[model samples]
Target: MVRIDDLQVFIRAADNGSLSAAARQLDLSPAVASAALKRLEAAVGAQLLARSTRSLRLTVAGERYLEHARAALDALQSGSVALAQDRQALSGSLSLSMPSDLGRNLLRPWLDAFLQQHPGLSLQLQISDRVADLYRQPVDVALRYGVPEDSALVALPLAPDNRRVLCASPDYLARHGAPAAPQDLRRHSCLRFILGAAVHERWSFLRNGERQVVTVDGRWHSDDGEIVRNWALAGLGIAYKSRLDVLADLRAGRLQPLLEGYDTEQTPLYLVTPHRLMLSPAAVALRAHLQQCLDAYLAGPRAGEGRNDSCD
Candidate 1:
């Protein structure tokens, strides 16, 4: 095998015109450096140098191989430098798998602004309700609500305090009086969402440190989260949705949060990667940008008294 150190010695010896000089430059004994040149020549089946007691210079074969060796070394060094830089600079492609409702309605604009700031950065977005298979899919990171079932995944909190808010459009509320409590939801039309195989029929809430679990029924149900939000917007029924997904609507007063005093369910948002080492610079920067956007959004005035309305 052709050792890289051998090639380095040959190149340096040829450039310096002295085996001893090259050995000193490389911090290797003269005998070791000379042996490296011989091993390299034997491996390549060519005499790479013609050395005398007074002088040392490249032979015909050495002249032919020197340029190629230098180029190979340069390529390897540059590759290492680029890889190290990639760990620090947000200048690469970032693939994100996110829920349809939040990805399209809420995060789209924020992510757009983020891309504008990083000209070299690009995005590949997979917007879906089904959980992304991190091992099977080409996803770099997943922006999802709720804890990851895979304990091995590195979940970076995007919105740890986010919740699942129960809300309905004003038109729906006017037609059928809003439910004042979690148990009251049984009397009104609810907009249910099917996550995977499970139907979200049971809703839970906490108020005054007491728990309330309601088995709610609705006329409408959809696998698509955005569709449920749309149905809620069209006054079809009350919807239980991720807070971030409905933040814009809540602010615009298009959807009114029901059960004011009662704290609804939690749906904390996370940026998930296969492992901590898999987290790239671009993903880290994107996480920061999304978090800042959420914080700023929550701080903004509510359409009404501008409730603190922290990003769920």
Candidate 2:
């Protein structure tokens, strides 16, 4: 008979693309993991994996069985949770992916507090600017800043009012006078942010119900948003950045908003998951916790009172 542990081992092996890696993750010996897979294949009466010395590939039968196996496991987990008398104590591991800037500057404290609240829970965080593949990567959820382009994923909004703001330090503005309008940014030193191979030099704004795109240039650019913010803080150049990223600086008078009359396009934040039903109890709890924290922060009294823009 195929055991639940065997199914779990098979699923982990499929996800990692290596039996040894799966065994390591599950704290099982390689021989035991191999035997589990063999027993699972025999019970199912089909060859699940095509194994070689160097690699392993899922057979057609394995590919079809994998989805069902995952669904069954999820259902079992949900049912177990439903039957449990103590639902407040959540115990499990959650893996998350997020941008480097938000992960370090914003979410780090929030996550630390969350971990403190749940002693039984553990977390694995992957910080990178690149968007992670939910289906292929070893992440349960991703906190992203824009609308998801993938139709297969489910996106839950965390912050709808989040937007990019054109900002510069007081010293920089004093030295080179803030741009009076979006078009005037062409002559100013605008720090550019690069993602992958693309340079995000085109800054967009909306004024009087009309949209405009201004192509700006700068002497320095970096792929990391945090670096760009640091440059802006040092009075290097103007930067078009997310308000959440520069909120504290703006409030403290280190950075001042530019193009105040013109509103930038909204880039709402989202908590993305692979599937709603596939979400573990730990993931669900974290999602709610994040939403509450973000909402409270955005709705606080200091949220909208920090702009020192003279243009508006």
Candidate 3:
């Protein structure tokens, strides 16, 4: 049987990226921490961690073993909570990662409310448009779009989101005349998102239950959603983007949805984390809070609802 204390030390060391830092947090000396790691590795009969003067890295076996180890630890902690459910109070750290556009618009307010409710917990929020790898990052939870391919993590559906709409300002439409059909877009200027540019530069449309992919060329491309959005606002070109993200602008007459009939599939947004049987108090709290906010937002009226020139 693995000693819980030893496993805890190993996890803490891995998380902190240093044995000394783990020792400091656990209130143990570096020597004691080092010895604990050695014992833990010996009991497992595999080299779990690679040690060097400059860096600590997980061996291939270590990487595989770490997943099970974390799950086991979580189960144990959760069991204790279940046993003491009547008297337990949540107090721990929660690290989260999210895509920038969603992070700014959807998650910010929920986070604010979560912090107010759980004053004792600590949170670290990392925002980036680039997909974050949960294995490489030490976050407890993440809010992400698109389905995750990692089998080691568990993804929970938080909200329904999908195919971004192609949109532009009315001034742009008046100046460049609206393309009545997807085929007409080939001649129009487009603003493209950089993440999947090679694959998504050509926009997609659906017709009579049939799918058609259009390879669109544009004078401008960016990885930043906000930047591409701003370009659309300036009447530069048509931009494909999330409905929620563009709803406000569409309502205010700053932007117009170019084609509404083509979007057939919607992508689901998710709350994800490394798979574990039991989640900590902070993680649980945040997940619940996010779902609550999502439900409320979806039920409300669309942002910027009453624009003068409409493209619904």
Candidate 4:
């Protein structure tokens, strides 16, 4: 049987377009990536990739083989999840990645409770504003907002990732005046989340059933959502934020919504893991616990309102 690690290298190299990029994603050296690909090809007795000075191209056989290998890895992961489901006690390390804002404000309490329940389970959670690779890093699961591009991973939708109201603090809104239309934002100070892929970095809105993309100019830009939130709360500028992030402030009249008739671009939230047949007990436990926490949180009184984090 071909080693799973070799197949993983093969898949990463194919997906990422270069051995070097794949190596970086996988935390391996370029030579290690190349060697693994060679080993995989040899074990399969087929030339999988055509390599040149500047580019890597997949052979027809490589395409078919990649599909099969990915399926096999997915089956393995699914099986692990199933095995974990049968166990009464979870005992393993589970690594998770999540956007820093959501992890800190929304899921912190639930995570604490979960850790208490599974004393043997160790967690390594990396809170990031950018998306991390599930196959590349040691993360077992990830909390992703928006639709996933990769078909290989299994994404379980946990909540309605709906449009949120964008606004500034009352003092800022009073000074800057609320945007009468989406176009009016061009004259206002906008705070932006400058991290993540370019796809998610831009602000989008809809008005009169027409969609608009605004390349916003901000006086302050940061990768950290908390910092952006603070800037908005300080009445520095307008921030386009999720209701989950700004709900409490809205209720308290700290921030006032602008362009009330326009739609705020929304992204769905999911608990994603490698699609496989077997998942470790710890990962399974965390996934379920996260879902429950999310459900309870969304249903609770604080669901749509923002919580105060002025210290942010």
**Candidate 2 Cα RMSD after full superposition onto the native fold (Å):** 6.1
Clashes of each: 2, 0, 5, 20
Q: lDDT (0-100) at residue 125 of candidate 2? A: 98
Q: What is the TM-score of each predicted model, taking all chains together? A: 0.69, 0.73, 0.72, 0.76
lDDT by candidate, in order shown: 0.84, 0.84, 0.75, 0.77
Tens digit per residue, CA lDDT, model 2, 78-98: 786565425568787889998
- Candidate 2 clashes between residue pairs 3 or more apart in a chain or in different chains: none
Candidate 1 per-residue lDDT, tens place, 18-103, comes to: 99977886789999998999999999999989989999988899999987887776666556555865765567798999999988
lDDT of 4: 0.77
Residue 13's C-alpha lDDT in candidate 4? 78
Winner of 2 and 3 under TM-score: 2
Tell how far residue 16 is off in model 4, in angstroms.
5.8
By lDDT, the better pick of 2 and 4 is 2
User: Given candidate 2, what's the lDDT at residue 15?
Assistant: 73
Q: Give the poorly placed runs of model 2, Cα more than 4 Å off.
A: 1-88, 301-312
Local error of candidate 2 at residue 281 (angstroms):
1.2
Estimate the TM-score for candidate 3.
0.72
The numbered model that scores best in TM-score is 4
TM-score for candidate 2, residues paired by index = 0.73
